[model samples]
Target: MILVTGATGHLGAATIHFLLKKMPASQVAALVRDADKAAALTERGVTIRVGHYDDTASLDRAMQGVEKVLLIAGTDEENRVQQHKNVVDAAKKAGVPFIAYTSRTLKDRSTMANLLMEGHFQTEDYIIASGLTYALFRNVLYMDVIPQFVGASVFETGIHLPAGEGKVPFALRDEMGEAMANVLAADSSGSAIYNFTGSEGYSFADVAAVLTDLSGKRVKYTPAEPSVFETQLAGRGVPDVIVQRVIRFLTDIKNGQEDDVYPDLENLLGRKPASLREGLKGLYNLG
Candidate 1:
């Protein structure tokens, strides 16, 4: 059986949906912290196992008889490193055959978004050190995060970001989920690391143009220094660490650190992932 942690989350739910197309419900399990939140999945013939990164025994119990496990990275920013370590240790004890982890793109040298990437890198290191057959899905930024570019708050006035005019490859969460499903279902031959990203790269200015076209409103891109951006976010009640990390990511993008587009996702899924324009069309109505 294949077990998916964080099954109630966006990416996890998408992964489970895609996996259902390839495997039977009986062969799938969802490891969640709250079984109540998983009622919909439970009705669909998925086995729900209560577990959390903080609970090693719960994780071990959930992993019982599980052949493949998808360790969806925990969202807790402060305790994420320890949380991932716990999950990895439990997976080791469970003797699961294949362990698939969702990590960040360019983690080995990511100066941008180190707050987010550091946890992913640490988890990747732990997985490699575990000596288990593993597959790492290094995912890029999600198109969903683009929503932050709008609104009356920060970007409502102007597109304020530290990423100058550089383009960065971004992918939708569903695309990453589909690719992850493929990795989880495939045979564990030689372990592999796949960098999952969209087929095209777009800069903040390009995104601003898309938003303007979609909303029929003029939007301007304003690039700021990383320090200024961090101060602005902090003054607006954004946590200092999160603000710092986001600014760093934008700085990296401005420096052309995350500008490459890779076809690893399409090669894995045998199809092209959704494009930015296509993904943004639906959100236009919401905005």
Candidate 2:
């Protein structure tokens, strides 16, 4: 059987949803914290097992008799590495043969500079050292969050960020979930490391042009300084830690950490992933 951790979250749930199309619900299991949130999965005949990353017993129990597991990344950025390690230890103890982890796409020389990259690299290393057969799905930024980053009425407000001339190859979440599902169900003989990304990269300026054309409004990109961006975020009541992390993220993007385009996603899906305009239209209800 296949068990997916954090099954109630966006990526996990979407992955399970796609997995069902390719396999039986009885062949799938969901390790979720909230039983109520998993009613949809339960009703669809998916086995729901309550588990928490911090609770080793829960993870062990959830992994019982599970041959494969999809370990989703935790949201707690500061302590996520420990949480992921806990899951890895349990998976090893449970004798699971294969583990697939959702990791981030990083430059070859990232050096674990930022909080996000640090946690992911730590988790990847721990999983590799765990002596379990594993596959690493290095995912790029999601296109779904672009609308939120750009703002609701972006044509009037403009695209505000610290990134300048850096292009991000962003893939849609559901498409990635589908690709991951394909990976989970396929034979394990294929490449163990998969870099999932959009077919093309887009900068804020390119996004502004797309929004302008789609919304028929004069959208523009405004690059802000790190201090200015942090000040705006703080004035809007964003938490200090989150504000700092956001600044770091924008800085990384500005430094071209997310600029590379990969053809892996297209190869996985056997077609072109959604373009920037297509993602924006679905996200912002633009025509």
Candidate 3:
């Protein structure tokens, strides 16, 4: 049996859908904090287990009779490290043979986006130290973020960011979901780390050009300094910590940390991942 945490979330739900194609629902469990939120999944034959990172008993209950578990990192940025630690501890206690963790693109070295990499690195360290067989799926920035650019273009006619014309390998969330399912289904022999990314890399300017071509509008890429970008986000009511993290992420792109595109995802999926053009079409509602 395989249990997936954060099953009610975007990537988790997608992973469950992909896993269902390869395995029976009885063999898969959706671990969520709220059972009511998972009614749809339950209707689809998934066994729902109420669980939370803070509650070890709940986690233990969810891990009952499960052979493998996918620990989808929690969204709570403040206590994420501890939350991940809790999950790792539970998995160790449950004696699960294989565990899969979702992480970021580059985590070895400190870049401008240290905030984003810190949690991933710490969680990865915890997983390695737990003496459990684990696979790290280090994911790149999602193409789903294109909607932020599209919304800005429609409202402000310009996209402003701290990343100044740097190219980054961006993968679709659906592709990442499929890759995670494939990794979970495979044997846990090597316990390798996979850097999941799309086939092509693109810069902010490249995204602007795609939007211009698709929308027939003059969309411009306006680059700002990290401080200025953070201030702008703060002015818009975003929390200071989150704004700072966003600025740091953009600076990492400017430094080209996310530019490397690897074939790991395609090799696992046995098909080419979605392209920027194809992802944009769905985001912009363009047929």
Comparison by TM-score, 1 against 2, better one: 2
* TM match of model 1 to true structure: 0.92
**After superposing candidate 3, which stretches have Cα over 4 Å from the reference?**
154-156
Task: Give candidate 1's root-mean-square deviation (CA, Å).
Answer: 2.2
What global local distance difference test value does model 3 have? 0.84
Q: Is candidate 1 or candidate 3 better by lDDT?
A: 3
lDDT (tens digit, per residue) of candidate 2 on 64-171 = 999899999999877889999999888899998889999988775454335567788788888888888898989998999887787776878888899888899889
Against the true structure, whose TM-score is highest? 2
Clash pairs for candidate 2: none
Please report, in order, the local distance difference test score of every candidate based on alpha carbons: 0.82, 0.88, 0.84
lDDT of 3 by residue, 1-287 (tens): 88999999999999999999998999999999889999989998999999799998998888889899999989988898899888888878888777889998873465545565788888998899888888999999899986763354453567778899878778889889998998887667867899999999998877877777777777777777877777777888999877777777777888888888999999998999888878887877765
**Backbone clashes, each candidate:** 0, 0, 0
Candidate 1 residue pairs in backbone clash: none
* Model 2 whole-model lDDT (C-alpha atoms): 0.88
